[model samples]
Structures are given as structure tokens and as C-alpha cells.
Target: MAVLTVPITLVQAAKQGDKVAFMSLLEPSLEPGYRLACGMLHDSQAAEDAVQEAAFKAWRKLGQLREGHALRPWFLGIVANECRTVRRSRWWSVLKWPKSEHPVETSPDSGLSGIELRRALRRLDLNKRMVLVLHWYLDLPLDEISAITGISVHAVEGRLQRGMSELRRLMETRDEN
Candidate 1:
């Protein structure tokens, strides 16, 4: 596979213990990682924690990143794994995940749409949700999404179709109320 736009020089420098290079290399992925975690975990703090953990792990394993690999999807795969870990931890049941402190900026007419969309998205199963979020929200292609989720491209397409259907059904159900 072709390498993502992240410069090979940056990757090489990062591997040689260059903190600045590592930070620069990792910067592009931060928001996408946070967004993915937020959609998965539904709590800003947990999402932040997950992203932090993923970044740390990525830094530690910087040497393992293969040449010609797309860094964004690969790093997101790590973030997804971190989210799964957070979900499975013993204390997860006891912990109360907090709501997002930052208010979403939406036009008056469209504000309700944002809320409805989020609710509909929350209704999806993790597998379906990840596929949907990775594809639509992050603007990743089906093949890139498959790489991040460790699923086949066909499975990703199926999940995307199902997820969109479910989201539409959910939004329509809300409209009936």
C-alpha cells in the first residue's frame, strides 16, 4: 500500500527518538482520534483519555510502523483498540461517563438535526457505529475504514449500508414523536 502524506523523514526522525518529529507526525491524527473515541465512548473525558493512551502507545511503538503504511488509519486502529480496552475494563460499569462540556455550534434551523443525528448514531451497535463514523464523519473511504476496523471491505460496505438504514429509521422514529 502507498504511504500516507506524512513525510517519511518525519517518521524516520520520530523513530530515532525525536520528540518534536514524533509530535508533528502525530498531530494530524489527534482530532480524528478524539472524534472516533467520543463517538465510541460518548464521554469527552474518556475519549480524551483513550486518545492519550493511544498516542502514548503509538509513540512507544513508533519503530514498528512500516514504511508505505498510511499513518492515519493505522493510528486510528490503535485508538479503536484503546476504546475497546476502555469499554472492557472492570471499572467501566461503575464509572459514570459525563456529557460533552462543549456546546455544538449549529445554525438555529439545523440545531435540532445535530441532536437527532447524535441520538440516532448512539443507537447503533459499536461495529456499525464505527463503520459509519469512520466513513461519514471522518470522510474515510471504505477501504481505509476496513483497515482501521480490521474488517473486510465487503463487511465494511455492508455495515455502512445497515448503519445508514438504522440511522434513518431512528431519525424517522424520533420525528413521529
Candidate 2:
């Protein structure tokens, strides 16, 4: 449900060494940027870093942004790229010890009280996680998610459906337990 209305003139101004314009251009995206980073990284610190890095990248590439195109997806593409970079740097070690090897067990009084949902979400492959986060948390449409992640629209839709189904199953199992 993000409706970006910032004008191309603002972006053009930002591209022409206008710091305030750039800030204005970047402002609306800050919240979703953090959310996307946090959901994908699942670590507050890493998420912050990812958002920071994404902001820098966006600044660097602001000129490449097309007129009339919304900025959110462009910004998200940067965040997703940062997440991939950070994740790849640790790919070897993480692959050696997959997080899914041991599922997260929830307990009563958990603040995240819906720990099963979080666990199941975390269990999904990175592509599925990205799709789910963009579609569910960010409320991005499948076309927008596909644009942000550079995947096919159908692929994004499939991942979202699969991720939701998996999450539901996990929640149901947790309730039964």
C-alpha cells in the first residue's frame, strides 16, 4: 500500500547536487527500508546496516532512476541487493550450519507470542522469505515484488503462496502442541 507521489523534479534536483532534495526523496522510504532489512536479515543490527548501505546505494544511483517511476521499489531493490551481499559473505559458514537444522521452539509469554510464524518464516529459503516479506510485511504487490527482486511475477506469487501455506502449517502445529 505504498503510493509514492514524489515528483521527478525532486529526483532531478537531488541528482544535481541538491542534498535537501535527496533527503526529501529518501524520507518516505525510510520506514519500509528498515522493515525490509529487518525482515530479511532478522537481526536488528544487520538490518540497520543493510538499510544504511541501501540508502548510500540509492544516493549513488539516484540519477539512474527513471522519471515517473516510484522510488520505493528502486530503494527496495537496493536493500535486497545489500541483503544478498551481506548474506553471501557469510554463505559458506551459514551453509555449514543451516538455521533450519534446529527449529526455533516457542514458549508461553513470548513477546513475539507468535513464534511459530516467525520460525516458519525463517525456515523458508531466502527467495521465499524475500517474497513473503515484500508481499506481506511491505504490502507490495506481486508485480512490485518481482520488480524489486528481479524475479518473475509468477515466481513471486508462487513463493508468497508457498510461504503462507508453510506459515499456516507451522502455526497450526504449534497450537496442537
Candidate 3:
């Protein structure tokens, strides 16, 4: 029998107290973590908090990580879990309330259509929204998304199809109005 060699052995060494190795291991994963957090929470502040918490948790549990090639998805799973935790907290309710006043924006890109599109996205159920962001925005395949979300591949496909239809309807309705 041949012994299998894996890159995560370096990560395991880092988990044993090699700071440089850990930093090297974690550097590439941060942006995706932030994006996932933002998609899950739909608020910049909440997303930042979730990413930070996820980083801390990932550090603490680094030793448990078994696969280096799969590290991105594993870290994203932690960030998504943190986002769920933040969303469930009481503070999230306060954050959820829409503010009465608006800040004037100079960016022409943020037109009425863009605003309506975002509002329509927010109208989606959380699972559908997650599927859309993960598949469409993040460009994850159905199987990988299913792994991260703990849904079956068929369920992921169904959610993506339903979400696309709903989003189309929403944009059309907004245009009509």
C-alpha cells in the first residue's frame, strides 16, 4: 500500500503553534469569508462581525481541519454558521428595522432599478437567497453548495430554479410598478 500525502499536514503543524504557517494557510480565504458573511447577513456591519467571529473560531479549531484543498469551503462554512448565529441574536432584530431617513448618494449606478433589484432579492426566503448568492454570485457548483449548505444536490438545483423564477417575477413586477 502507498501512503497518501496531503498539504493539510502543514496546516496541522500550524495548528500545533506555527503562526507563520497558519497565516499563510488563512490568507487566501478572507475575501470569500467576507462575501459569504455579507450574503448571509445582508448587512455590512453584521457581515464584518460574522467574519471576525468565524476567523476566531477557525483558529481555535484549526487542528480539526483535515483537508487543505477543501479549506476554502470549510472556512466559509464557519463564516456562514457565524452569520446564522448573528442573525438569530436579539441585536439582529434591532438591526433589521429599516431606518426612516436616507443618505443621499452621488453614485449614478445606484439608480431606482438597482435599489428595487436589491429590495427584491431581500424579499426572497433566506434559503433561496443563500442559494442564489452562492451559485450565481459566488459561482459555486450545485454539489459544492449542497455540501456547504447541507442540502441535497436535487434540493440545491430546485432552490436555484425557484429563486431564479422568483427573482425574475420580482424584477418584472417592480418594472410594472
Candidate 4:
């Protein structure tokens, strides 16, 4: 399902001490947030933890959100930062890596294809992978992605292009196997 952009009214209401409203604002961003966290962290449990922490931080910092601003980008920024924190934890590396979560119902070829795609994605540097996932998977607009990533639109564009080029090359090489 496509994640709808959070309504500006919800953003305003959430800023005014409305907990329900605050959660309402976050509702639309939840699925996208989870997907982002999963893509970044590569672990369902870690993704959930990251999203939960980010949601808590988003609520606490709701007041800091400016009136009429796009909540999705700002909120996504928090989620991205939370994922970074999770990845940086010393224990994160010492622990066993997450097991592959193959799709239960997919055809064998498609399932293997997905694994290959994910592996290719993981090979990209975080900065490039981040832009590719946000733009392709999350379907976020360029300006919103730029804002969330704290980079210029031009830079976002550059990263998206370079990331896609690299990802394509990796996939082609894998297909030769």
C-alpha cells in the first residue's frame, strides 16, 4: 500500500498537545518507516526497535515541528537516524546476523531474485542505498528525500543516479552465475 502523506492539519494538531493527534500523524508514516528501517538494518526485530524509538522521539519532539511542514520527511529523518544508531551499537556486530526472510508464497525464481536484489542493495554504500531505497521503494519525491537526507536536491539526484547505476551493474554480474 502506498503511504499517504501526513495531513498538515494533523501535524498542527499533534503539535498542540494532542497525543491521539500525534499518533494520527504518525499512522500514515508507519509502514514506510518500517520498510525503511528494514532496508537499512536488514533485521525485522531491529527495524521494529528502530521505528519504535523513532516514534517516541517524534512524539517528544512534536513541538519542534514547524506548522505546515511536511511531517513525512521530518519523521523519516528521525527513523533514519534511529537506524544509524542501531547499526552503530557495538553489540550489533557481535550478535548473529539476521536470517534471510524469504517470501513464503513466491515462486522459486522470484524468491531467489529477491535475495539477489537485496544482496545487491546491501553492497551499495549507505548513502547511495539510502537514496535508492527512499526514492524507489518508498516513492518519496525528490525534494522530500533531499530534506529527509539533509542534502541538496542536486546531490540527491546524483546519488540516485549513481546508486542505480551501481545496483544495475551488480545485478547483471550476479545474473551470469
Candidate 5:
């Protein structure tokens, strides 16, 4: 499959210290990066912070991006790494308060299934969760997910399959309750 990418000229210009060119290259990626961060971190504020930090790291490391590489996946890889870093920080666990015993009231318009799905997703280990989010939520192909996660395409497919199975089991178990 043909890989879509920004013009090489723009990347080159960005690498040459052109801030506008950098922003132009970076603009289209922000939303996806934010979404990826949110999926991994499961906190909007943390996600936003992760994305911002990823953007800065991406800018600093733009020169390291190989020619012909798509900026989105590379940027997203950085975002994923940033999310992992956020998750690994000592403050992350300390900051996570226990969930209240009270069940949240859902508005009719708010999809309960979505909420349940997110809860199940949060229960998944980070490896499976990352692949599930990158493939299913982000609609990224296995190869792209592989690139983003720095895993083999086969490994990504395995994780995707296992993640789907686990998610299904989680959903089914929830339904039984």
C-alpha cells in the first residue's frame, strides 16, 4: 500500500529550522496524537499534557526522522512513548484516586456501552490496550500500528487478536453482572 506523507520539501524545511514549516507538518497530526494520548492515558488533562510534551520532543528530534517516513506515525510514536512515560511516572499511581462506590448516572444520550467499553479497556494491560487503541480506536492499519509501537507486524496482529479476545471476554463478563 502506498504511504501518504507530507511533501518532502516541507519536512526538509522544517528540518532546516523553519518554524512555520514545522507547524504545517505538525498541525494535521495534533488531533490524532491527542486521541492516542487520551486512549493510552485515559485522562484528558494527562493526554493533553502528553501530546504537548510529545510535540516538543518531535520538534527537537525532527532532524532524526528519516526521509520518506510519514510524519504522523513518527509523531504518534512519540506521543505513545510520552503516554507510556506518563503512565510510568511515580506520580501517576499516587495521583489515581480510588473510584467511588457510587455508580455514575448516565444521561440517556450518553451511550452506556461506550462507558462500559472504556472501563473494560482501562482494565487491560498497557501492551494490549495500546494495540487495541491504535488499531481499533485510531483506525490505523497493522503496519502503521507496528511502526508506531516499534513492534513487528506479526506481533501487532497477535496483540490485536489477544486484545479483542480479552475485550470481548470483559464485555461478556460485564453483561453477565
Candidate 6:
């Protein structure tokens, strides 16, 4: 999906506490933010909650946003942080159920590979996984990912390479078993 460009006037209005303008500026980012959360958390419900909480936090912290900065990456960064918070909660482990060993029968068009890919993604460490999600799943460029991750472009590139290598190893290992 194409990212929408927010008008500078709208951003100014939002900074000045215009709720409508804020919502307008925020609307386009919600889907991508949710997808980013889902990619990180691997649970749709948790992802939704993370995105919602991030949206609230973004509004509350809007004043901290610097001028000329892009909102999409900023919002996604908030979503990513929220996902991490949710994962770190004490209830996170308690809420997770072990997956069955045997794969369920899926229809021909069900894209079972996608399911397996997500399972493998869940096995990755958060840093590598976040880079993989932001780059591959969200189609974000390295610079934007660097901004969101608070890392250098070189670091982002390294993570992407390592993440892809690890992901490939995991996928190959899965195929062998």
C-alpha cells in the first residue's frame, strides 16, 4: 500500500491540538502500524491492542515530534515499542500456547507457506525480527527503518543480512524435518 503524504498545514494544525487534523494525519498510518505489530507479535488480537495503545501514546506525545520528521516511521516506532512492552509483560508467557507438532491440513490456496514463515519469524530474536519485518513485510527502506529502530543505516543493513540468513536457515531446517 502507498503511504499517504500529510499536508504541512494539517501537521501544523495537529501540533496545535486540532483533533480532526490529528486524526486525519493518523488515519493512513493505522493499517501499516497494525501490520507491523502483527509481524512482531504474531498474534492478531495482541497486535490490534498494541496499535491502539501506540496510537494513544502518539497523540499524547505529539509535542515531542520534531519538525520535518515523517509521521509514518515515528508512529511505527511507537507501535514497535508497544509490541516489545506487551511481550515483556509477565502475562506474555502465560498467555502463549504451544503449537501442535503436526501441521493442520490446509486447502490448496491457503498459503501454508505464509503460516510456516510466520512461525519461523517468531523464532528469531527481536532485533533481527524487527529488521526483517520492517524491511521485507512492510517494504520500508533502510533509512526509514534506521530512523524507527534508532540505529545507523549500516546497522540496519547488517541486521537485514543476518536476519535473512537466519530466516533461510530456519526455513531450510523446517523443510528438512
Q: Point to the candidate with the largest lDDT.
A: 5
TM-score winner: 5
Off by over 4 Å in 1: 1-3, 103-109
- Tens digits of per-residue lDDT for model 2, 1-177: 544656878888999989899998898888888888778777666777789989998988888888888888889889998987887785634644324432323355765656556777777778888888888787888778887888898888888898888878877777888
| Model 5: worst 10 consecutive residues (lDDT sum) | 97-106
Give candidate 5's whole-model lDDT. 0.88
lDDT of 3 by residue, 1-177 (tens): 111223766777777888877777777778777777666666666676778889889889887777634666677778877877876788777755443242322257768876776688888987888888888667777777876787899999999999999999999988887
Q: Global lDDT of each model?
A: 0.85, 0.79, 0.75, 0.83, 0.88, 0.86
Candidate 6: what lDDT?
Answer: 0.86
Q: How do all models score by TM-score? A: 0.86, 0.81, 0.81, 0.85, 0.89, 0.88
Candidate 5 accuracy as TM-score: 0.89
Off by over 4 Å in 4: 1-9, 97-109
Deviating ranges (above 4 Å) for candidate 3: 1-6, 96-110
lDDT of 4 by residue, 1-177 (tens): 223456777777777778999887888788889888888877787888889999999999988777657778888999999988887799987999666564213345767788888899889988898898898878888988888899999999999999999999999999887
**Residue-level error in angstroms, candidate 5, position 112:** 1.5
Return the lDDT, model 2, position 150.
82
Per-residue alpha-carbon lDDT of candidate 1 for residues 1-177, written as tens digits (9 for 90 to 100) = 333667788889999999999998899899989888888877778888999999999999988888768788889999999998988899997977667676333458767788789878878887898888788777888888988998899999999999999999999899999
Cα distance off (Å), candidate 4, residue 127: 1.1
Those runs of model 2 whose alpha carbons end farther than 4 Å from true positions after fitting are: 91-113, 170-177
User: Can you list the residue pairs that collide in candidate 6?
Assistant: none
Instruction: Tell how far residue 38 is off in model 2, in angstroms.
Output: 0.7
Off by over 4 Å in 6: 1-5, 97-110
- The CA lDDT at 20 in model 6 is 92
Per-residue lDDT of candidate 5, residues 1-177 (tens digit): 434688899999999999999999999889889888878887777887899999999999999899888998899999999988988999999897454443333458759898998899999999899999988777888899988899999999999999999999999999999
C-alpha positional error of residue 135 in candidate 1 after TM-score superposition, expressed in Å: 1.3
Model 1: lDDT to the true structure: 0.85
TM-score of 1: 0.86
Candidate 2: Cα lDDT at 135: 81
How many collisions per candidate? 0, 0, 0, 0, 0, 0
* Pick by TM-score: 2 or 5, better one: 5
